[model samples]
Target: MDATPSAHAAALWVGLHLILLLVLSVLVVRQRRKHQVVLGDADIPELTQAVRAFGNATEYVPAGLVAVAVLAVAGAQPIVVHAVGLVLFAGRVAHAIGLSRSGGSSILRSAGATATWVAYILGAVALLFYAIP
Candidate 1:
């Protein structure tokens, strides 16, 4: 295995997610301004939803990105890395859209959450496989 990490695939995915997160942040900011919410959702439901959607992405995306990057650096197969990345990105977008619209019982939200978990689990397994001697 090459000691130097080849992170081209990982970098692409990370860059895409970063942009997604930034767009989510902008959405939240726009909601806040539109609703005149100064801080902490301001008891506005839409604002609250937007904040949580953004927060959820922040909570989930970094760890996913790290896992993908580590796998890339450790020389995991490119297909596996891309698969995980695509699933994670789709999940985040779905979750954001679902949660932004309705607070409860959304197919998109459920699928998104499931996909995110699957990506994380698969990433961990891949990492463990590479790390084990």
Candidate 2:
């Protein structure tokens, strides 16, 4: 089976990722504006730390998504694929927001992180099942 995505679906996926990246960039820029710090400035430790957390989230979210897309293209149930993608997207957005906020904590961040991991695991399990049968 061809793994190439339909034009509309591919556009939607690309747009979704672009939106995520753009939102992160906007958050960084807004914080910099509010604090008047260059990207390398060490004075704004909290902002710097928040940016680092965002980076960490970015790393995991996309990797999980790649697994999702691969499994989806490999014939995981379409409904499952959509549900997983939606959950992962929601988690990434929520995690990013909580991390950027001053009151963020392990609990708040963990909610989204856990959701993302579940999505990844679901995709992996589906892939494994497909491979075995």
RMSD of each: 2.3, 3.2
Runs of candidate 2 exceeding 4 Å displacement: 1-14, 103-107
Candidate 2 displacement at residue 38 in angstroms? 2.5
Number of the top-ranking candidate, with lDDT as the measure: 1
Tens-digit lDDT track for model 2 on 37-73? Answer: 7766356766675575568666876776676666556
Native-to-model Cα distance after best TM-score fit, residue 133 in candidate 1, in Å: 3.6
Quote each prediction's TM-score: 0.93, 0.76
- Residue 45 displacement (Å), model 1: 1.1
Over the stretch 17-111, how does candidate 1's per-residue lDDT look in tens digits? 99999999999999988988878987888888899899999999999999989999888888878888999999999999999998786999999
Candidate 1 lDDT? 0.89
lDDT of 1 at 87: 90
